[model samples]
Target: QSYIFYGPTMSPFTAYLIIRGISTLEIRIRQQEKNALKVAQFLENHPKVERVYFPGLDSHPQRDLVKKQMHGTGSVLSFVIKGGYAAGETMVNNVELVTLAVSLGCVESLIEHPASMTHSELSPEERKKSGINDSLIRLSVGLEDAEDIIDDLKRAFEKV
Candidate 1:
């Protein structure tokens, strides 16, 4: 019973194209999740990584629950650095491919430190309780080839 109430400027072909792309969002997410799990696995074994946290990892505390309830891992994951806050900052600044930015769920990868970026305004005690530590680096994997993504990350570690 829903009617298509588009403007005269909107061509039927263009409208249908937009609708088709929107409808594939779920499919796109599944593919991205699969790609992300592969990247997470690579990072986990990398010598520079102190810890990798992805819901797909069996070592992750919520892995089973996430697998049961979620269709995908949602493309974003966080990890802690061995040297803590300073090391995280070094990696963020040294990375060439991945951008440093807030927000997620995009077609391009992004990295950010919540304690100094998004949650910078929070009080020290609030940040601690929330587990948004200065040493944490959050990555939102994108459509790029996973090898290239991991290579860029490894390059960043060289500078850190």
Candidate 2:
């Protein structure tokens, strides 16, 4: 019963899994960053995207500082849709390949609407103050083929 209350140690299999993950961490991260940059570029030029918040993009306000401080821009990015909250929801709903989830930095692409999902508890004013607009959408780019990710987002954008 005491053992059940709190595990004395993690399983060997779990430890092995952790080690295996660490072994490929660098490779996976490189691929994820590459994919994220491609996706960010696409979103930056997309008509439906009001603004893309990826530091890798030349248009990003902090692009110079980001380049100075970071090797890669990172796998997660956020954007504001041209339409409002409903547009964000509709686009996310229409995605075929990207999964809708609040969790990020996984092996698979994930998308979320902060206003309605992660930061839903905040009042409109509070959300606005935090720069989480109604049309804001966050995406965690994965290791999937960049074209496929762009295609998936293109299809979703059409619905907005």
Candidate 3:
């Protein structure tokens, strides 16, 4: 597909890099998952967080299904801040360690606001139908120590 625009296929060196990544993928995922669960729990109990939506959490609506089919919950989560768009913007702006980025699934933590970022093109009704909100924030946990991530979040929360 579209091989001419890109290449006939991936170069040998790129394939080798992907193969190398595959070797440690599982370990990386597990560590990210662990960090995510901790981050989720912290958010769930925080006064500033209105709701947390990580499948690893006991409070997750699909917890039963998650347990049945998944060995571990992946490292991404979405949550609602107690305040709306302004608060979301403040927290993201204040982040010192976590990066405010649209790209995720990385070695470093990343955060984004779907209402204004990924789903910005959608109209109000469309956004409502898709469940994206002014306060909704997505976080992709990374390889950092869980405490460090929490501390970064706490600093951000103080601004909100």
Candidate 4:
């Protein structure tokens, strides 16, 4: 004798969900890449940005190594504020569109105080040795229109 069980198969629904998520992820990732490149180019020469650390910039110190080791420059880059911590914190707070938050790899732009957020877990000496400081601001570029994002940054810098 043999026994047969009947139930709704979940494979089709699961496949659809997987495919849908992948498609959305691909689109957002492409947009984010384009946006990041544009923003990096903009900030590279901006007066307030002492240095833009995005690999896409030919002037970036590690551009050569980046070309050989990385698939993309990614959305995040750290820049030093002109006047140090006071100016950096002011810039972070003045931004309207960019959210002051931790983490990266999101569709929405985020700014974080690594010295107090990601590096806060480390002691002052450790943070200093690791090159994380109050004067540095890390930006996670988002999928927003490049011009609007730049405009927001310009406005924020003006306030800073």
Candidate 5:
């Protein structure tokens, strides 16, 4: 026997549910964007960070395009650690306030080493070709206080 599957369609109830959160979601997302930019700036200046990739930063190659297309930069940012995978692991493992997790867009802050965690199955060459180096770390800034988050990163860097 063969089976076919169909996804649920958007009904009035679903639309109502989505509309209910729009206003609050918009406010929280704007705050997250601001916090993310601040964190990115801090990481860019840190000695342990080799580079940061966030469109909100002037260093991003597509910053001009980001300014044209979006009112605010999104909350996600990635950076390369100076000491490679081992340092990335130490930082993620040591973070107390920022949860070490693979997912994104949560209410609490999260940090992860994409090379050793998310993309571990791939070989080093494959990961390198994909622009995911052994030292690369991905962060999803959430609704947490910006200073607290930055402090969490600073503490974690001490471990590295």
Candidate 6:
């Protein structure tokens, strides 16, 4: 037996256009990866950051595997703040260049505190089981200058 279902507004033309835009998309992705790695490194050395999770970092346990399998590490990273949940909230609120939004893979930087924003519905035990702690702050590095992004994070950390 064979089965097929159609969505309410699937657009073949839009899909075709997106397929044709792969080259430009790849260039943006490369730049994002570079900027993300830079920001991750910056955070790793920051006094207020307890830990950084980025596949591109040497400290990541799977870094070798990631480098072997992927063209480049993606543009997202997560770090735990020293002050836990309150510090995470403060950093997200104070960031000017990095918007405090849940969505990712955009042209502008985005940040969110998953414990309070994305996965708030989950109980503390559930969130911890999923490796999301109260201090975790997710950052989606965008197509901005690496230094500018780092500067934004620095200012936010100061407020924290």
What lDDT score belongs to each candidate, Candidate 1 first? Answer: 0.83, 0.92, 0.92, 0.83, 0.92, 0.92
Per-residue lDDT of model 4, residues 1-160, tens digit only: 9978797677988999979888798678777878888888888878988877788788888889999998777788778878876788788889889888987768899887676677778887887898877678899999888898899989989988
Task: Score residue 29 of candidate 6 by CA lDDT.
Answer: 91
Q: For residues 3-90, could you state the per-residue lDDT of candidate 3 as single tens digits?
A: 4465478889999999999999999999999999999999999999999999999999899999999999999999999888788878
Please report how far candidate 1 places residue 125 from its true position, in Å. 3.8
Could you tell me every candidate's TM-score relative to the true structure? 0.82, 0.92, 0.90, 0.81, 0.87, 0.87
Overall local distance difference test of candidate 3 = 0.92
TM-score of 2: 0.92
lDDT at position 74, candidate 2: 81
Model 5, 95-155: lDDT tens digits are: 9999999998887789999887999999989999998889999999999999999999999
Candidate 4 TM-score, C-alpha based: 0.81
Give one digit per residue, the lDDT tens place, for model 1 in 12-112.
99999989989987877777777788878987887768889899888889888988998667889888776766788898888778889988778788888
After superposition, the stretches of candidate 6 with alpha carbons farther than 4 Å from their true spots are 1-20
On TM-score, the leading prediction is: 2
Give candidates' CA RMSD values in order: 4.2, 2.9, 3.4, 4.5, 3.5, 3.2
Candidates sorted by TM-score, best first:
2, 3, 5, 6, 1, 4
Cα error, residue 75 of model 5, in Å, equals 0.3
Lowest summed lDDT across 10 adjacent residues in model 4 is found at: 112-121
Model 4 ranges off by over 4 Å? 1-18, 121-124
For residues 50-85, write the lDDT of model 2, one tens digit per residue: 999988889999989998999887899999998898
- Clash counts for the predictions, in order: 0, 0, 0, 0, 0, 0
Model 6: per-residue Cα lDDT at residue 68: 88
Question: Of 1 and 6, which scores higher on lDDT?
Answer: 6
Candidate 3 has which clashing residue pairs, if any? Answer: none
